[model samples]
Structure formats: C-alpha cells, structure tokens
Target chain A: MEHAATAPEPGPARVAELRRSRPRSPLLRFSALAGVALLVWAWAAGDIYESHLTAEQKGANLDRFLAKLTPAPVRESGDWSDFAPWAVRLLGEGRGAEAVLLTFALATAAAALSGVFALIFLPGAARNLANPDPLGIRGGRGGLAAAGWHAVSRCTRAFFVFTRSLPEYVLGFLLISVLGPDPWALVLALAVHNFGILGRLGAGVGENTPPGPARPVVAHGGGRLGAYLSALLPASFNRMVVYFFYRWETCVREATVLGMLGVVSLGYLITDAKSGRAFDQMVFFVLLGALIVLAGDLLSALVRRWLRYERT
Target chain B: MNGALQRCAGSRRATLLGIALAALLCGWLLGLDPRRLFADGTLGLAGEFFSAAFRPALSYEDPVPGAQPFLLAALRSLLDTLRFAVLAMAVAVPCGALLSFFASSAWWPDLRRHRALGLALRALHSTSRAAMAFARSIHELLWGLLFITAIGLSSEAAVIAVAIPYSGILAKIYSEMLEEHARDAQEALRSIGAGGLAAFAFGLLPRALPDIVSYTFYRLECALRTAAVFGFIGIETIGYRIRLASDEFHYREIWTYLYLLFALVALIEWWGAAIRRRLKT
Candidate 1:
C-alpha cells in the first residue's frame, strides 16, 4: 500500500504527448464518416421493410415451406426408412447426379482455361516484366520503348479491372442471351471473370518474386519473354498453382449458381424445383450443392497444404 | 542433394501433368461442342450487344407516355442496390464479429489453469467453426432463394439471406487474421493478471482491427454485387432493371444499368483502397 501510494501516476504532460503521438489520417476519418452517413441514409430509406405480404401471410408461408421440406414419402409414411429410397430415386432418376457432374465440369474447364489465359496475359500486366528496364537491367531502352511498355502495362491492367468488375452472374445472363443458352455461354462467362482475377493475382505474385534467379537470365542478355519463361515462371509456379486452386474453389460455387440461367446445372434444378413448389426436391438439391462446395473446398485445402509442405 | 533436387522437380512436373489431364477429362465429360459457339445468328446478336456499349441509353428506346425518364429509373434502382448492400453489411459486420469471437481459439485461457472452462471453450470453438463452414458452404444466392421461399421476398429476407453467408465468411477470415497476428502484447497482458477475454480485447483485437476493417469493406463490395444479383428474384435492384431491359431487347438500356453497376463497384473499390492506405500509415 505504501509503495502503491508512492507510485507516480502518468503525468498530464506525458498524457498530452501520448495523445499527440497517436496515428491520424484524414482520409480514414472521412471514410468512417461516410460509412456512418451511408448507413443512416439506408436505414432511413426503409426500403428493407417494403413487402406486400402481411405478417400472418408471411408466417403461414414459412410454416408451409418448412413442412413441405420433409420428403413426401416420409411425411406420408412417418418412417425414416422411406427417406433413403426417396433420396436414391432423386439422385438417380431426377438428373441430380448429372447436374452435379456438369457443375464440376464447368468449374474445371473454366478454371483451367482462365489459368492458361492468365499465364499468357499476366506478364504484360506485371510491372517488372512490362517495364523497358526489365529486371532492373542497367542502360535499358529509353524514350519511346519505355513509353510503349508503360502503355501496355496500363492497358492490360485496365482490361483486367473491367472484367473483374462484372459479376459472374451478370456476365452469364448477358452471354446466355447472346449465345442462345449454350453451355459455352456459362463456361465463357466463368472463364472471362476468372481470367481477370487470375491475371491480377499472377501479376502480383510475379512482381513480389525475389528477382534473384530471374535476374541471371536478364543479365545473360535474354529477352523479357525468355527470362519470364525460364526463371520467373518456374520460381513462382507453386504460388500460382495455389492461387489457381483458390479461384477454382470459387468457380465451383459460381458454376452451381450459373446454372440458374437455365442451361443445366445444380442451380437450374434448384430453380426448377422451386417453380414447381417441390420444396422437398429443392431442399435436397440445395444440400447437394452444399456438399459439392464442401468437397471442392476440401480438395483445394489439401492441395494448398501439400504445396506449402513441399515448399518448406 | 542434386538427385533429391531432381526428384523434387520431377514430382512438380508430374503434378502439372496430372492437373492438365484432369482438365482434359473434365472437358470430355462436359461434351463441349465447338459448333455451338458459332451457332446461327449468334454473331449478329453478339455484334449488337458489343455495339451498344458505346451508346448506352439516354432515354427509353420505346418511350411510353406516363413512364418516368430513363436516367431517373436507373438512379432509383442504383440507390436501391446501394441501400440493400448497406443494410446487409449492417447486419453482417456485428454478427460476424461476434461469430468470429466464438470461432477463434485465440482468446481461450490456459487449459492447465482452468481445465473445465478450457474444455467448454474448446467445445464452443469447434461448434462455432463447424457452423461457420456449413453456413459458408452455400452461396448467398441459394440462401436468398431459401429465405424468399420461406418468407416471400421481403427486404428483410434478402438482407438476412445475404447476411448469413457473409457473416460466416467474415468470421472465418476474421478468426484467421486474429490467429495470425503476433501474441506478444496479449501474452504481456496475461502475465500481468489480465483475464483472457480482456487481454484479447485490449491487446489483440486492436492489432487485428485494421485488417478486419479492410476485409469488411471488401465484403461490403461483395454484398453490393450480391444485392444486385438478388434483383433477379424481385428485389428491384439494378439487376431487376437489367432483366427488364433485356426482355424488351433494349441492349442500350441494359448497358446503362451495367455501366452504373460497374461505376458503383469501382467507386467502392477505390474508397476501400484509400482507407486501407490511410490505416497503414
């Protein structure tokens, strides 16, 4: 108690100095204020509560919906034994299995194609490679050559940004109309969006690479393309693969939903079930989609873990 | 050592080969046809769609006497989309924070110090993590469909649908960030007799706050996209307008809505980057 009483508190001068030393950024303040303002305005708009259904109607709808989710056979027989056969029939006769396979195929094809395209185009967006002074080589090209390289980099980046901004569903919606419901429409939609993401990610990986092995190729008077192929590509291959799997996981999720555009995937089946008011079938297909996503996530995680283990 | 390095390189090549083979197999299974890409009349439609990009609609292509102007309708839908996104984020952020708190193991007390409590906390952590995974397994669109089927497509249904998966995703990332940050400060707090949760709150949460905020902003951008997509199911966002325009073969009008969406996404992305930079400094 005597020692505690003798301990000096933080003096006013020290407290004032602490306040002065705190990190400050006007942009952050503005952003926080804007975010709050937006929230207030959104709440005041009251758009979220706009519904034609009365409370009673909504309650009834919910009750009916949940009741409908039980398998019809089980609901009638009151036996858990009926569920297995019903599920088996749904998987076999109802085209659910085919839809699942198609969803997986769509994701694989799109991700592979995007990975290929990204490899080809990402170098143009990579600052280290796109610069005239490639790999920081001394006395590199100047003036017009430098300007041309800069232009290519800028244009490539802009193109990636444009594609990345378009949501996959929006792209699929437009492509389906233009291409007339072909599977190519869905594949292309997924591919285009993912190409942008992969390109950007690949460019970042390339830029952040140590530039150790890659510099030797440049020093040996190799061209930018030569250096990229022989050194940077090999050095960053594992990292690129990791990003590919990450995007592929997302592509699987998107492909499941893309089928709602009416081509033929898990999403289409879910939508069809809903329109027919086969709530039981809808729930089954939704669960099936969830299973597919979980499987995809597991696969990607395993591959990423392997990659990490090998690298270390 | 040289032989081992060669073997490592060989395995890497084999992995690449395996991936390529898998892709080919998937392509074969899909039975993709090249002819369908060039199906009759697709070129004309594609040309028309591309051409419309340069001249987005300034007014209705086929004007109706009583209908509001084109720009005004686009503006309204844009605001609706933004409002829906904001509402969803409002629900998601706090829910995500709470979920992440339970999901993470970072705040757990020393097991030796409180054995029974530690076991309970461990159980809670696993349960929260499993719930997060299950919730995140389904896409938000499907969640929206489920909610709409159950509740009949109100704004609350849409917001909740978006919030569910977003919260799960945010929680997962937030927990990872919390775990990844250094625990020196937290340990110091604990050594001074601070409670586990208190130390985490004061010492660790602030260290992870900037990253968490940045990611939340990113999630808000995603929520905006999801909100637009929900317009397809009758939420009256920009996507609903795009659907309407496309049904009428109003390519120019569709482009207008698309450009508006793109502009909004671009603005939010820029704002997020600025905020992140500020936080870093």
Candidate 2:
C-alpha cells in the first residue's frame, strides 16, 4: 500500500523531470543544421575554388564542356550537339554518372564475390581451429614438450602481427609491380588483404567466448569440434557479424583506390571530374560516394542492433 | 594436453608439403628450369640484384644525388600526412565522446523512453557514423582525386579529405570506448541532479581522456602510413616521390628515399609517444 501511494506521488514529478531534462528540440536542430552547414560551406568554398583552378589549368578539356554550358548560335542547329541536356553539358554528358554508377557497381560486386571466396577459403582454416590437430603435435618425452605449446602460440601471434602491420594500400603498391596491372589483380589483392583481417577477427571471436560452454563440452570428453560447435560458434556469431561489416567498409574504400590503377569504378569519376575540369561535378560525386559508404555502415548497424538486443 | 600435442604433430607434414608445392610453383613461375641456375655459373638477374643490393650505395664522401630530392619530397608529404592524423584525432575524439552520451542508455530511467530514444540516437549515430566511415573508406586516393579536382591539388585538401574518414573512425571507436567504460558513472550522475550532458562531461570525460590521447597517437601513426598512400592522386608525398624516382629508374635513390622516410617517421612517432608519456606523468 505504501509502494502504491509513493508511486502515484512520484508519477507527476517524473513527467515534470522529463520535460526539464529534454533540451529545446529547436535549439538542438538549429545547432546541428548550422554545424553541418558551416562544414559544408567551408568544404564547398575550398572545393569550388580548387575545382575552378583545376579547370583553368587543365586547358581545352573543360573548353568543350564549358562551351556546351555557354549559349550557342541563336537559331539552334537541332543537331544533337546544338541542344545539350543540363547535367550532360554541365558534367560533359554521361561520363560523370557513368563513372559513379560503374564504381558503385564494382564495389557491390566485390562484396558479393568476397563472400563467396570466404566461404570456400575459410572452411579448412575453420576446421583446423575447430577440430583437434594431431598434425600440430611435437613428440617430446621431457620438458621439451612445453616448447610445442609455446611455438603454437608464437605462430598465432606472429600471424596477427604480420597480417595487420601493412595496410592494403602498401600491399596493393607491392603487388601492382609484381603482378602487373589487371582488374583481377586488384580483386585478388583486395581479397588477400581482407582475408588477413577476417581471419584474425574470426580467430579472436573463437577464442573470446564465455568459459562455461567449452568447459562443459570438454569435460564430457567431447572432441575439439564438439566443443567449438557447442560452446564457441553461438557465442562468437555476434562478433562475426560486426567484423564482416567492418571488412565490407574497408573493401569499399579499397575498390575506390583500385580505380587509380585504371581498374575502373567510382574513383574513375573522381579522376574524370578533375581531368575534365568540372569542379562542381566533383563535389556532387564526392557526396555521392560518401553517401554510399554511409548507407553500408547504417545497414551494418541495423543488423548489429537486431542481433545485440533481444526483446524482453 | 594430449589432444593438443597430437594436433601439432599432424600439421607438420601438411606444412612441409605446402612449402614444397610453393617452392615448386615459384620455380615454375620464375622460369626455374633449375638446370640454368645450377648448371650455368650465372646467378641470373634476380640473384644479381640481391647480391648488388647488399652492397651499400653511398659513403660519407660520395652522397647519392637523386636520394635527397625524393626524400625531401617524401618528407614534405609525410609531414602533411602526420598533420592529417593529428588534426583528424583532434576533431574526431571530442565529437565522438560527445555523441556517445546520447547513444548509450545511461540517460534514461524507464524502459519506454529508453527504447524510443535509443532507436533515434542509434539512427543518428549510425548515419553520422556512416558519413565519417565512408569519408575514410573511400581511399584518400579517391579523396585526393576529387579534392584535387574540386579543391585543387594542394596538400591542405589532401590532409582534410584524408582526415574526414579517419575522424569518423576515431569517433566510432571513441563512442564504443565511452559506452563500455562510462555507462555506470554516467547513470549515477544522471540519477542525481546532473543533466545528461553535464553528467557525461564530468563522469565520462575524465576517464576517457587518457584513452583518447593514447588512441589519437595510434591513429596518428596510421595516418602517417596513409599519407604515403595518398601519392596515387599526385600529392607528391614521400610515397609518390619514391614511385617517381623508381619511374626515373633511380633504384639506389629509391632505397635512400625509403630509408629517410623510415628514419623520419620512426623519429616522429618516438618523439610523440615520449611527449604523451611525459604529459600523462
């Protein structure tokens, strides 16, 4: 009865507290909009000014596009050249959109392709970790036996150190010369670099689950695979999802970079914008590329949220 | 222990077979008609480069000429890269920490409000987070490419463009750190007379500062490497300069330029870390 009385008394007070706690939504909106605006304005100023300079410096390429933007002869020739679509003339016809579309398409394709590659390449490694490896045994009767575990640990540690030390950029640079420039080359390169990251992340997930699970399975004389399936897989599934998203984000960036080598994609738009001397188009495309990545991350977050919290 | 030990023994044969096949493949690809390398007293071109590479390129008296231009160029570019890292950290760490207060559930007492606010905050966080992420994910090369076209080919655009994505990453990490460590303290502050923002500042900020600084330096080091990577868009940073020298067929100068960059990057990192340690003390 006292609990009920106290609850009724506090209910009105709690509602008042929320109103006080909430910041002025308008003020919050104003600040956020202003902040974003300020950054955009600053970036635009710098971006626009540089674009102008590049257009001027690059010479005749912009002449064709700029000329198209300028008013032509009064009596239009009715030829396809006489009348230009707004973005077409402004962006030098379809090239800008094409570049954007192409690169975005490539990134999407690469993500799917890599998933397939992972499914194929990872099973052995997964089994190796999940199942007991008689192959790892070093037969030594004395204290030398302890060294075996140490060696195994050292190898695992070294694998991580080597995998993460070099970013894919460096790897791409090294492989570019060795393999020569092929579209497939970049794909292989991206996959290899990403594989290192994925494997390390995967191993971490396997090792870091709660102890209760594996102990019970192992205590029952279950094999390594049994312990892993019973204990680790379920626990690590959450981490695996997050890691995949992170890798996908990295892959998107790599696909853009690979474009520099004439691999062709969205980065090509960036190159075209600069080369064609259309600074405005450059801004549009940069925003576009940024949006695509932003979307990917949002998707990842959505999945993570769904998995992380269960409905009471 | 027995099972674990047995596993190791089994992998050795596989490991040996893998090496043998790899060696065989290498020989096949390199035109390893072993008869030529073994029968003829010629060490071949690769062998020749390896042997020659071991010999030092310069003495105190005879300094390499092409080396300095490349090194200086790389040094200048690397400085820009380092600047990007520092500035990105500066921008991102605070923003990320600020956002985390809202993103986490510490501010809410009841289930209904928390769920609604949590969803909203998550959406906002993810979108902004995505912006920051994509900003970095699009390689600085792409960033450089667009910026060079739009903003012109200056080091400043390169730096800022590169920084945008990194800052996004930094913010994301910082938010996660805040979520993990400051949840309880933030809640305690919120339960009392403290406002959410106020509680976050007092409760979370102090604990997060050390980590922020440590991670900032870590990110700074990463940025340094990225700066070199930015050469693709013609930034003429250390990496770009090296590629240029190589194109000009100055192999010895390439090594020299690389060494200079290594020495400089190492020095800067050590100096920065020392300063941080001292500051912490």
Candidate 3:
C-alpha cells in the first residue's frame, strides 16, 4: 500500500523527466531527414552506372587479368620453383630492398618532424591558453584585449583545419610539381598534414587536462607558458605520444603510396611494375607494402598499450 | 621520491635518444640533404605556387576555343567525388555492421551454459578478426590499384576497392566500441529474462550508438579524401581535375578545386559535430 501511494506520486514527475531527456527537437529531426535525402539524391545522380559492358564481358576481363598475373617464367616452365628465384632477383636487382627502406625512413622522418612542429605550434591553438586570461587567471579587462585573443585563437584553428583538409596526396602532388619530385616534397607533404592533425589533437588534450595541476602553477605566478610546459605538457605527454604513434602508422601506409608521385618507394616500384605489365611483380610489391603497414601497426599498438598501462 | 624522479628523467632522456637515432637513420636512408631544399630555382617555383593560392582562378588560366566552362568542370568533379564516397560508405556500413557481430564476443552465450556453442563462436571470432586485420593492412589506394588490375578499372571495381578497407576499419572500431561499453544495463536486462540479442540491442547498442555514428561520420570524411585520390587512377574525381590542371601548370585552378574540397569537408565536419551534440542530449 505504501509503495503504490509513493509510486503514483512520483510517476507523473518521472515521466516528465524522461520526456525532457529524449531528443525530440524538430531541428534535429529535420537535419537527420535532410542527411538521408541527400544520400538518396547522391545515389540517384552518381556516376557508378557508367559501364556499359555485360556481365560476361566483365567476367572475361577479370579472367584475362588473372591469366596475366601468372609470372611469365613460371608460366613457361610450368613450375613453381621459377617463382622464388624471380622474386629474389626482383628484390636484389629491382631496387625493391632500397624502396622498402626508403618507405620506412620517409614515414619516420615525417612523423618526427610533424610531432616537433605540432608541439611548438599547439599552444597557440589551445582554447585554454589562447584566451586573454589563460589558465583562468584574471587579466586586464579590456574589450580590445579579448578581441585580439579571440582573433588569434580563431585564425590558428582555421589554419589547422585548412591544412588538415588538404589531402596529403594532393599536397604531395602539388609540392612534387614545384620541387621537381624531390624526397623533400614527400616529407614536407606528410609532415604538413600530420602537423595540422597533431596540433588539433594536442590542443584538445590541453583543453581536456584537469585544471587542478595547472591552477597551482598559475597561482605561483609561473605564467601561462611555464604552467603549460611544466604541468600540462607532462600530464598529457603519454597521450600525445600515443597520438604520434597512431599518425606514424598512418604515415607509413601513406608513404607506401606517396612514392607513386614519382619518388622511389614501394609505391613507385608498384607503379613501375604496373606500367611494365608485370602483374606478378606489382602484386608482390603491393603485398610487401601491406606487410610493412601491418608491422607498423603492431609496433604502434604495442607502444600505445604500454602508454595506457603507464596511465594506470 | 628522489629515485622516482631520477627514473622519470632517465626515461625521458632515453626517449629523446631513441628519436634522435631514428631521425639520423631516416636521414641516412633517404640521402637527405638540407641544402637540396633550396636548390637553384626552387624558391622561385615555390613562391609562384603559393602566390597562386591567394588568387584561385575564377575561370580557366588559359582558355581553349569552344570548351566547357571551368566552374562546370569543377562542379562535376566535386559531385562525382561526393557520389563515390557516399556509395562506398553505403556498401561499407552494412557489411561492417554484419562483420562486427561476428568479430565481437560480447553477445556470446555463457560458456558454462553452452560449451559447444561457446567454442564454435570463439573459433568464428578469431577467423573474423584475422580477416579484418588483413583487410585493414592495405591502404585503400593500393586496394584500388589491385582492383583496377583485376577487373579492368570499372566504376564498380573502384567502389569495391574503397569499400573493402573501409568495411574492415568500421568493423574493427565497432567491435571495439561494443566491447568497451559497460555491461551493467545488459546484465540487468538479461536477469529480467530478456533474450541475449534483445538485451544487447536495447542495453548496449544505445550506449554505443552515438560513438559508432560519430566514427562513421569521420570515416565519411576520410572517404571523401580517398575518392579524390582515386582520380589519379582515372576515375574523374576532383583529383583527376587537379592532376589535369597541374599538368598544364595551372596552379590557380588547382587551388580553386582544393578550396572547394576543403569547404565540403568543413561543412560535413560541422554537421557531424552538431549531430553528435544532439545525440549527447
């Protein structure tokens, strides 16, 4: 009898709370509906229906390509033994070994360069620091001072977004054109894109860092820079390193293909093989690139796992 | 306290040493020379390229008689890129969701209640995980090249190529999200006599849905970039036009296309952010 009386009393209030918590805003519904409509329109107007070939023709084309994929020497001798020597010769004489090394080196150099650059520039992008009163420390109360800080913050964020938006391949292509296909162009392209990403990520880390440690630094008159360097940086170091490794793994994958821009990496070798109509060699290089990416992934995962353990 | 501080300093120093060693190795392998960055005429070319970025072309840098307008060409390229990205996502999302179920062990029956079924599910889980790893190891561009080789470069082949790696990525993340969420609600529902799938759907899915959606949006953004990259292989996306403009030394035209791509990405990011905020409520 007591449960029934109390339940009845709170039922209406509880229902009201539930109703308020649900996402029933008309604008949200409209936006979701609009998104689905746009997708439907995209499919209707897409260029995916361009091929006029019948199904048999498509199958035949695939079969012909598969036939070409058999290594030429192996096909002639009808023996799998010829394949091993051919692959060994390809690695020894076709510069495959050098290209593999170059791919890894390019990724490491770009990742390290970007990590350094991002660390240097991220303070300007951090919301907590770019304000007039950093770390919640009161400063001169002037509208002009606030406006200036806001503009700086906005411009820095916009710059990061703009650089991040430019696909690395596109940037590499543009850079290679002006730089005459130099390795520097590839390195710069990868670094610039990753720098923007890391800057954004590192700024987020700064904003999300607990205010407790940083407040004491500000109270001691260490200034925003000192507080950031001494407190926030150390607090977020493991996370930033984790992000760095994640980006490095991506860089390795990208470096594998960025070589198709006419540099010498796994991608360049693969492209060369494709043009030479050596399907066997092309597939081999592609698999080798995949292997490198998997290795990079494993290494990054292990480091990230260690970092997570450190946090606990 | 003193020993802990010393250990921290030692680790920091070691990390720095490792980075230095890696950078030196990279420099040696790449034959890197700082002097080459400022080689003769390089500064002039770079200056010309950056200057054009400020004044993106409103039309063709060099006109040809009776040619289509530059803006029309750019618009077409933009739409094609969007279409390709959307199509790839449409295929990848469903495939990924299906693969995720097999990959994730969260919904498995209790081992004590059903030993044979549990072992079989474990076997399926491992195989799905291995497949996902292999699929994700290859970059989408490489996958595109492989598909083009195998199937003669049709639109379907291109779409499939992009979809393959994307599905694996989405599946991996989705499974992780499912596994990461707290199982309190699921356990409660199960205790109340709900079916296993029902308990998972109502309890876990709701908690993980927002993250899964947010990640899918991020993947869509990536797909747009990948679609542009596909143009290099002759798919008539924005990258294709950029390549064409570059070939003719039309840096301004390249910038124009680049700005359009950036605007599209920024708009999508804003929309995704707004949706995520709403989901949080």
Candidate 4:
C-alpha cells in the first residue's frame, strides 16, 4: 500500500518522460531515412520546381484564372454570366441529371460484368481450390487433372495481374481508339479493370477459406465442386459482397473521370462548360458530380450496415 | 420459432429479388447491346492494338529520324510519373495527418464539457469534413485540368492537382480509422486527465498507425495511377506519351510506355506489400 501511494501515477507526464528517455524506434529512424531519400529523389526528378516561365508570369496567370470566378460584365462579346440565373438554368437543364444517371449506369454495368468475370476466374486463380489433393479424387488419373488445373490457375492469376496493372484511364484511351468514342468503350474499360481487382480479391478469399467445412463433404462422396458450392461459396459470399460494395464506390468515381474522355457524362459537361468559359456552369456540374458521389457513398454505407446486421 | 424462421427466409429471398431487379434495371438503363459490341470493325482494331501491345518497340537502333527513341522517351516519362506521384504523396500525407487531427471526433472528446469550445470545435470539425469532401469530390483529372488552366502547365500544377484530392481522401480515411480504433484508448486517457491531443498522440495514434500506413500505401498506388492519367493532359508523364503514340497510330510505342507504367505500379505494389508484412511483424 505504501509503495502504491509513493509510486508515480503513470499518467501523461510519465508517458512523455518515458518517451523522451526511450531511444528512437528503428521503424521511425528507417522511415525518416526513406523520407529523406525520397525527397532528394523528388528534387532531382520532379519538374514541379523547374519552370521555364518567370515567377511574375506564373503569378499573373494565377490572378487571371482566379478572376474568372467572378462574373464578367454583360457584354455581347463575352461568354460569362451572372451567378443566379446561370445556376438556375444549370439545375433546370436535364443534362446534369442525365449525366448522373449515365455515370450510375456505367458503374452498375461495370460492377455486374466484373462480378461475373470474378466468379468465373476466381476458382481457377485460388491455389487451394485449383490444386486440391489428388488423393481425394475417385480415380488414379488425378495427377494429370491436377497438373492441368495448376496451369489454368497460373494463367488466370497472370491475367488478373495484367488487367489490373493497367489503369482504367489507359484502358479507356485504348478502347476509345478501337470503339470510336462510345459509352461501351468506357464500360468495357471499367469492367476489365474491375474484373481484375474483384477476381484477385475473390481468389484471396477462396485461398484463405479453411478446408475444415468442405472436407467432411468431400469425404462423404461429394465431389470437390459440390463441396465448394455447398461450403466455400457460402462462406466467402458475404466477404465478396463487402468487397463488391467497396469497389462499386470506386467505380462511381472512376465513371465520372471517364467522362473526361468526351463521353456525355458529368465530366464531359464540366469540360464543355470550361471550354465555353462558363465558370458558373462548370461549378454547377462539379457540384452535381459531388452530389452523385455522395449519394453513392450513402447508399454503400446503408447497404454495408444492412449486411453487417444480416451477418449477425 | 418455425414461423420466425420462415419469415426470415422470406425476407432474405425478397432482398435477393430486389437486388436482381435493380441490377436488371441498371443494365437496361445503360443501353447495353451485345450485338453492337463487336460490330463496325472494332474487333479488328482491338486485335491490332492487342497484338502491338504484346510486341512493344524496344529497339534503340530503329529510331525515328530526329525523334528520341521509344524506349528512352518511355523511361523518362516513367521517371516523371514516379516523381509526380512521390511529390504529391509527400504533400498529401503530412497535410492529411494534420487535417485528420481536427476531423476525427475521438480527438475532440472534451469539447462537450465546455459549451463555447464545443460549438467552435463542432464547427471546425464540420468545416474540415466539408472541405475534405469538396476536395475529394472533384476527380484528380478534373483538378489537373483546373490547375492547368489556373497556373499553366507547370509540374507544380500537376503535383498540386493530385495532392489536393489525395490529401482529402487520406484525411477522411485517417479520421475514420482514428475514430474507429482509438475511441476506447482515448476514453481511458481522458479519464486519466490527459489533454485531448496528448491522449490521441499517446493512446490512439499507435493503435491506428498500422492501418493508416497500410491505407497510405494503397493510396500511393492510386496516386501513381492518377499521376499517369495526368499525363493525358500534357504533364510530360507516361500517359502523355501514350496518348501521343496512340494518336499517331504508333501502337508499338504506346505499348512501350504502358509496359513501363505497369512495371512502376508493380514495383510500388511489391514495396507496399513488403511494408505491410513488416508492419504485421
């Protein structure tokens, strides 16, 4: 009791004192070193500091751009308009709503297509599922089947890596070239990238699923496919749903960006307004894009909440 | 119990049906026509693109008359892309860390005890949250375009454009992580009469640090991709070269640039994984 009364309270001050006395953690030291190295490399390689234009010219350019935010005088020669009616017209115009719908539609299609592809390829890419024990097979011919399955798994894994490594914007660019600036080009590009992501995630889920539940079924004369369908799929489906919703959120954002490629989406509207020098209209379109993303975010949140409750 | 089981099952079925219907509606709205997918010579064009992508122009000997070789140009653009992403992350991570301190509810637990302070803190929190949302809501590509218009085509514009939205995203994620993981520890510290910031620093930050670091690495990968996309707007990145090559029908050169971009992403991903493994240990 005496010792307890006499000892330090081990409160914030003590924590600070202890921290000050302790040597710097190796991780912290390593991170600092890495940060310094990165900064040095960035200094050498980044062009942000190396501008050909004089500072005054850059400052003037910034001022001019900032000036665009305010309404220009109503002249016959000018394209700018006052804020009130411009905003009213922006909301009244069905284009903004249509763009939101198009963005949603694109995201939904991409998610659906990617989900299908993920389901198809995930099994092959999962090592545990793809290369099940040969001894568990009914016949002695399991060796050849296992070898073939292993090859398929490797190929599927490679395909996922290849597709996912290429960003959707790059894919959109290539697809636009081939497909001639259609909505399908954006959809396909988004789908290809998402398919890779979802497929890899689903494969990870499959690889990590414990064999305990499925093993009994396999022992009871059920084929591996049957066991997988009955046990593995059900076990992983909830997690897959969670991942899908997360990816859907990202897809919504990507769909909006894809509009910059001349698609008739919110991004396209913003680009159009920018070119026309209608800053008000541009602001309106930007707000609408934000609204759509917010709504998508809200929906995802609600669905995730429901899923959590359902799981419990 | 039997009736309850049946009702639960019915609700589940209905939910599944609702989801299916929504998917169908969305698909219909998109005007997805399978027939048109391969029509109008798209297949041939896509085939050519794919074939050329597989066989990139790597030879330095076959240089175009006065132009730099494809490999050298691609490599340089690749470095530019890396630099852009790294510099942007450098700005974002620290800015986000600062913003997250204000944004996180757990960090301001004592606000309620003092009414005036509570109101001010609430306003600050809401304002910071709104600012982050606004920052992230605009896509990086749009931000890049806006920056280009604002400050001309300087690398500063590109870096700042990427940095703004990325910082917002990082701040939001960081706040959420702190809120989720630090609440209990923070409460304990508060009970011990620790100051808000001190409590967060001592109690919460360590618990949340792993997740924060992991998410940052993920965001860095994303930043790298965005940096490449900025190239499309003439940032002298790999995407710019890709666009130029594709426009000129130099598919081989496009592939070269793309392959380099892919390698960069792959390398980052590998590094991120290693860091995550270390964090786990």
What TM-score goes with each of the models? 0.94, 0.58, 0.94, 0.85
* Native contacts kept, each candidate: 0.68, 0.13, 0.62, 0.53
Clashing pairs in 1: none
Per residue, candidate 2 scores C-alpha lDDT tens digits across A188-245 of 4565656655765576566556656665666566655566655665556556656766
Ranking by lDDT: 1, 3, 4, 2
List, for all models, the DockQ compared with the true complex. 0.68, 0.11, 0.65, 0.53
Candidate with best lDDT? 1
lDDT at position B207, candidate 1:
89
Clash list (residue pairs), candidate 4 = none
Estimate, for each residue in A76-138, the C-alpha lDDT of model 1 and write its tens digit: 999989999999998889999999999999999889988999999999999999998888986
Candidate 4 segments exceeding 4 Å error: A1-32, A46-85, A91-94, A133-155, A207-212, A221-224, B1-20, B60-62, B109-115, B182-195
lDDT by residue (tens digit), candidate 4, B1-281: 89975775576567556656766777688776777777768878888888986788885334668787656767877878888888899999998888877887666756557999899888988989988888887778878777766667788777888889899999999998887773787778889899887888888898888788878977887887788888787777788877877778878877777777777777766666666666665
At residue A249, give the lDDT of candidate 4: 84
Q: Between candidates 3 and 4, which one is better according to TM-score?
A: 3
Worst 10 residues of 2 chain A by lDDT: A131-140
Worst 10 residues of 1 chain A by lDDT: A133-142
State the lDDT of candidate 2 residue by residue for B114-209, as single tens digits. Answer: 788667766865776555555555555666664544335665666667666666677677767666664677768877878866876787776666
**lDDT tens readout by residue for model 3, B130-192:** 888888888899899987777677788889899998999999999989988999999999899
Residue B278's C-alpha lDDT in candidate 4?
A: 64
lDDT of 3 at A145: 84
Interface RMSD for candidates 1 onward, in order: 1.7, 11.6, 1.9, 3.0
